[model samples]
Target: MVGAIILWIIMIAFLFFILHAVIQSALDSSNMAKNIQDIRDYLYDTKREGRTDKRAVAEQLLSTQPGAPQDLYEECPACGEKIIQHEPECPSCGLRLKD
Candidate 1:
């Protein structure tokens, strides 16, 4: 019957929308993870090169235009290394930066 066909079409369309949304979310998360990894690598390289003045890089990393928090850092109390915000402790030493 036409009614049954219409119902099936509607269900199919709803399923498609859900699938599309899930796929989009996955892609967004992947991109964000890749970006975070890239920033971490860049920061490590900069630190290894003896470039301690990383305020600029931190600023760039925290820029909201890049979808990150502003003025947030994972500063190490021991060596004063500026790291990303998500890190609970200093990557260099296991020192807790925040209380």
Candidate 2:
């Protein structure tokens, strides 16, 4: 009788462990799906806004700090698009930067 009780207890413990693992996996999958949907929505909105340039979108979304210098970016001479100060070439116009 004691052996039978021990076997039942072991089986119940194993089942509980498996049940918790499956529940955790389900929650993780749900969170991943939500994250992917959010990303899809964001990309769709960006495309709807007619913005194909990722750099321009990032620059526009990033607000400069109050005490930041103003010369951190410059316009590309060929296309008048904004370029980071240290970039060696303009991504939009393909113009070679001298400085």
Candidate 3:
């Protein structure tokens, strides 16, 4: 009788562990899907704006650093717009400025 009760308790604990694993897996998949959708949206917007280079898109996604100081701003060669020296592309003309 005592052995039977112990077996049932062990089984319940095992089931709870399985349930927790399933919930965590589901949440991870949902987060990954949302991230992919966000990247797609960003690519679509950039393409619609005439920025078609895939390398440029990748670089933009990888770069998260803030722009240089305002006093360090320089003229964009392609569009003549004032841009920070550290910018990878010209904001006004979509021209690639950095190597």
- State which candidate has the highest lDDT: 3
- What are the runs in model 1 whose C-alpha is more than 4 Å off? 31-99
lDDT per residue, candidate 3, 1-99, as tens digits?
Answer: 999999999999999999999998897689666676777888889988998875566566555324523365689988899776678998788999889
Question: Between 2 and 3, whose lDDT is larger?
Answer: 3
Q: Write the per-residue lDDT of candidate 2 for residues 9-59, one digit (tens) a residue.
A: 999999999999999888768966666566677668889998898666545
Clashing pairs in 1: none
| All models, RMSD in angstroms | 8.2, 8.3, 8.9
Instruction: List the candidate 2 regions with Cα displacement exceeding 4 Å.
Output: 32-99
Q: Give the candidates in order of lDDT, highest first.
A: 3, 2, 1
What's the distance in Å from true for residue 28, model 3?
A: 9.2
TM-score of every model versus the real structure:
0.33, 0.33, 0.33
Clashing pairs for model 2 are: none
